[model samples]
Target: MKVVSSRDFNQDVSHAKRAARIEPIFITDRGRPTHVLMSIENFRHLTGQTETIVDLLAMPEPRDIDLDGSRPTTWDRQAKFG
Candidate 1:
């Protein structure tokens, strides 16, 4: 992990970005940590947003769904609308 002051970060944004590719970069303001800079891959991993098609396919199939195929009666429609 790398810690950079806000002033230093603003001065050399590219360096911070490069460091973030390997690990998180902490940006500080007034000598306190304020923000983190990290690669998009890391961000997605931490947020659990890195699902692939294989992951989707690996989920267990749903079961026992019931469907009603009957058409609604005219009286049922009228009662619903009123």
Candidate 2:
């Protein structure tokens, strides 16, 4: 793990990101830990999230969609629900 001050993190974001690829980077504010930087893969593994954005985007489009636009009649609206 690497520790970086907020000022240093802001000044060189690329360096923090590079270090995150290998391990978690702890960002501190006023000598107190505030945030953590890590690769997306590590985050997903830690959170147990398996689906990626790419997987969601690659899903097949719905083939059958009900587009009926008819409005309910007054009698239909008055029907009781069990």
- For model 2, the superposed segments whose C-alpha errors exceed 4 Å read 53-82
lDDT of 1 by residue, 1-82 (tens): 7899999999999999999999999999999999999997999899989878987899887885435656553457557887
Position 1, candidate 1: lDDT: 74
Q: What is the C-alpha RMSD of each candidate to the true structure, in Å?
A: 13.4, 11.5
The TM-scores, one per candidate, come to 0.60, 0.64
Which residue pairs does candidate 1 place in steric collision? none
Residue 11, model 1: lDDT of: 99
lDDT of 1 at 57: 100
TM-score (C-alpha, index-matched) for candidate 1? 0.60
Q: How much RMSD separates candidate 1 from the native structure?
A: 13.4
